[model samples]
Target: CNALNASCSDCLGNSKCMYCYTDNTCKLYPSGKIIPPSSYCALDKARWGTCLVNFEALLISMGVIGGVLLLTITGCCIYCCYCRKGKNKRYEREDAKFESQRMERKARQEERRNERRSRLDEIRMKYGLMKEDSAPYTRFDA
Candidate 1:
């Protein structure tokens, strides 16, 4: 990796390399490690993959991004649970209102039925169609 020493961009173009400004050298990245140790190259001066960002800025940006994503997921879960609880309460209220309306309609229908029955009985008595007690059966004129 040290052979590609023309510039930082040329040095980091290779996947397995890091560039350091302190010594103006490009070194092979240590295998099996995500980031180079600060001892090898100071975080602020180390450039990898892109010359536009330093190692320190990359670490900070990645950490901030990951933290924000975690918080957003947690907030969404809490909001969903809270809204579900309120929805259940609203459903219960709707059911109760429907039951009350049904009861009122039932009572009104029963009262109307009773009133019609009484009116019919009064008409029957006025026309003498309802027989009195101790009456005898007899043939009537057409």
Candidate 2:
């Protein structure tokens, strides 16, 4: 890909070649390294994949995109946690309300039972049907 007169499009035709805007020269892409070292070609001058953008711009764009994506994911996680905490608090409040209502109902039911028992006992005593606690044994006489 050392064609000095070849256009960037012509150099990019080969997958293993990169074009440099500094010298307008086509050179073989360095597959061993991640990015072409400054020795090979300046970052701003190096073009890979397409001739529309330089390597420096590509790196910056990719970095920005990755950072934004990371921040978005982090923000979503935080929001979810906050919502879940609020949900738990709501459930606790509802449970406490329900328990208080249950207690009130239970107390009313107990009061009604006590009142009914007392009325029955009073009627038994008035009719002389209730047994005396002092007298363990008693004979029935007509």
Model 1 residue 86 CA deviation (Å) reads 1.3
- Model 1: lowest-lDDT 10 consecutive positions: 130-139
Across 1-142, the per-residue lDDT of candidate 1 in tens digits comes to 9799889999988989989999999999888778788889999999887999999999999999999999999999998999888999999999999999999999999999999999998998999877675558776999
Which segments of model 2 are wrong by more than 4 Å?
3-5, 13-15, 120-142
Top candidate on TM-score is 1
Poorest lDDT segment (10 consecutive residues) of candidate 2: 3-12
Candidate 2 versus the native: TM-score? 0.70
CA RMSD of each candidate after superposition: 5.3, 4.9
- The whole-model lDDT of each prediction reads 0.91, 0.91
Candidate 1 collision pairs: none
lDDT of 1 at 46: 94
Residue 76 CA displacement from its true place in model 1, Å: 0.4
lDDT of 1: 0.91
